[model samples]
Target: MKELYLLLLCMVTTSLGKNKSVDLELDYETASRLAGLPLHCAHVEYPNKLSQVLENQTELLAPSELHPIFYGCFDWHSSVHGHWLLAKVANLFPDTELHQNVRTLFAQQFTEDKVATELAYFNRKWGKSFERTYGWAWLLKLQEELELFKDEKFQEYAQILKPLADYIADLYIDFLPRLSYPVRVGEHTNTAFGLVFALDYARLDGNEKLIEVIRNVSLTFYTPDYDCPLRYEPSGYDFLSPCLQEAEVMSKILDDDLEYSVWLQKFLPQLFAENFVLEPGKVADRTDGKLVHLDGLNFSRAWALYTITKKLDDKDMVERLNAIGDEHIRTSIDNVVGSDYAGSHWLASFLFHALETRNS
Candidate 1:
């Protein structure tokens, strides 16, 4: 049995390298490997920080003790998106061991009681920014994935997680109004990156208020922004393109194709050029957590470019962007498998997001 599994894994890995199309889907073995990562770490806690404020003695607790459902993959947001990756893979390969692993993990960790404990941490005095918008966005993305899965077990998991999801949605509605300015950083706290995922979930779940808030806030923050200075982009530790992230959110918020085209023209006019080029971000050291973020930057840039292409009607432009997206994916998709723990722990989710966006 072990030899058979190894043979199958090798076959899948080989097939992945041979198929280099822009629409390349994650084969079962690749999905299983990526899903296996989170499954391996979902419970192993030690290299963990609560990212919380301690109001009392009880607040100083181990990660698993504090966040029963999300205490692994090095941090809160990574753990959340790790679960998202698992949920995605399980849906893709429902009859495989990947599904069984997700089922077992969800059954053990996604109980209402566990989620309540997770929620309690968020309700703490200094918890308003616990995971801030990044973690909150991913939790909603997980909920959206769960809601989409037709399996009864996934539906149950969605129901179990709905309260937490609802809380995050409410937080967005309350938080966005009070947020005077959007965080335009290329890292975790970037407001546009947060809104992109939250808006996706809100639209899918029919949360009118949440959708309205995101749309309004996005336009307010990003509209009239011209000359985004892509040349000055990619600060040393950036995992996201601040300029592209803004473009991503605005693309969703604006409904009119012409208006969006006009907005993109002003927002990222460089893209409108006939021979525009965006080199994939380079990572100096995969073992260095911050440096490895460049890998993620490549994937995210691909996602943003792919998303922007959807709103455009220019066939040549779309084709060019699609090729660029493929270049970005190729640069990092291979690195995802054998990178240092710093990169391996979370990069797969970004890769999955990029590929999923391309295939969508």
Candidate 2:
């Protein structure tokens, strides 16, 4: 595998200042570093955050006991997407050491017993809405990536993981309609961000129910939207870009390029301007868990804006998008590879997702 790595992708170097530049590419070294964060923490259960509801003293269980598969990486959602990050990286670079390690980890973790325990936790009284759409989306994303990878063992893992996936899908189907308005926050509850991945998984899984619910929810919440407050974006402690997340989700559901472009222009007219300038969010500190969200904000904004660029015929706007996208990546990627657990526990998944969306 190390020998084969010599043929791996080259790095993309971007200038940070007069003489300083950074490697923010999707090459092997960067990918390996990103994948390493999750591989190390996915099963390390200490220093975990449990956002659970306790029915009684009997429910005072450890995170590993509560979620057999997703009990690490700081929190349940981060753990779920950490698995997703590994599956995605392993999918891209199969026959590698990273892929083998991921295979081994999944074999140990993605068993019927583990998934059943996880599902039971979800089905518990007062636990139905636990992790809600965020963790659900990541779990679906993990299954989605597993199904896309080439290995037969990944399919087996996906099958073992399917019951939980189906449960989350049903949660979406049940919850979307009853909600009168979308959760437009920039954090875990952001409806648009959750729907984007869930919709992708739904379409891939051919779950028409999930797909239909997502489409209806999108149109219901966003079709009438206009003049999104992108300039007021990244409210402190924010990760997902509220404005761009909505636009990106709409880009997928619209009927045609013309239709989507029109809707986008109406919704976010600044993108149509001659010199549309948007800078990445600045993180003043990496040690603070909430403050570090700005780093993820930069990456997520890039991911959403990159998807919007695909449907654009405007060459200048697309170039602006690509430039800002790279800028966002370069701004926040260092922290993803840093030692601080505040950002390291989850930011790699955001970086990988942003890079994947940018490259795709």
Candidate 2 residues lying further than 4 Å off, grouped into runs, are: 1-24
For model 1, residues 92-147, the per-residue Cα lDDT tens digits are: 78888768868888899889999999888878788877888999999999999999
For model 2, state the Cα shift of residue 310 in Å.
0.6
Clashing pairs in 1: none
The residue pairs that clash in candidate 2, if any, are: none
Residue 38 of model 2, lDDT score: 82
Off by over 4 Å in 1: 1-23
Model 2 CA lDDT for position 44: 77
Question: Worst ten-residue run, lDDT, model 1?
Answer: 1-10
**For model 2, what is the error of residue 49's alpha carbon versus the real structure, in angstroms, after optimal superposition?**
0.9
- For all candidates in order, the CA lDDT equals 0.85, 0.85
